[model samples]
Target: MHSRHMSIVIPDTTADAVYAFAADPDNLPQWAAGLASGVRRVGDTLVVDSPMGEVTVRFEPTNRYGILDHDVTLPDGTVVANPLRVLAHPEGAEVIFTVRQRDMTDEQFEADCAAVERDLAALAAAVTV
Candidate 1:
């Protein structure tokens, strides 16, 4: 599988603030528009209504390390791992998202990457506001 790292620096924002917002599944729909439409707690998992279908998202336990890694289970029972991080930057905080090309064509991968870019931009806007 091939992977691409997409990132954006939110000027004047703290890593803690960025992490706090990004770590919450409920806030995903606000920034990650391409990934989630709505989210609700379902026992131990976060049930998400996505464009693909209803999926389950499992995030790593909250920590001070700025790790927002998560596993997304598709409706077909396929699990896709997403690695995300918020790091302290000179200006503010940098958010990085890893997009993987598991079994997609080059065009599909490019589209996926573009979507991630847009999402990261949205994240920066939301966190900085």
Candidate 2:
């Protein structure tokens, strides 16, 4: 299993507000650019137009706590678990995403981490804007 974790601090946002936005799979493409270019709902599932191909995404049920876990199913049927969270912080709120190395090389994993950082920054800018 891939083992890496990353987080970002979004100023002037509450955990509840962040969770409300991030927990929704429809908002993913707006923030997680590496995941998909766009997302649309089809009945109970979300279809994403990803660079890898069309993928399916399923998010966990909403809860009071800021747990935004989801699963992404690739065209080849590989399911990747994405564990995300928004937690209350002294300044504002912190969004955390688990970054798994998967089968990528070190350089690839570094690039993936960079992508996650960019995504988180986009999320920060989006919510703040």
The numbered model that scores best in lDDT is 1
Q: Say which candidate scores most in TM-score.
A: 1
For 1-101, candidate 2 gives per-residue lDDT tens digits of 56678898888889888888887776777798866566888876788888889998888778888888888899999998889889999989999999898
TM-score of predicted structure 1:
0.96
Candidate 2 segments whose C-alpha is farther than 4 A from its true place: none
Compared with the true structure, the alpha-carbon lDDT of candidate 2 equals 0.85
Residue 54 error, candidate 1, Å:
0.3
The parts of candidate 1 lying over 4 Å away from their true place are none
Give the C-alpha lDDT of model 1.
0.90
Q: In candidate 2, which residue pairs get closer than 3 Å at backbone N, Cα or C atoms, i.e. clash?
A: none
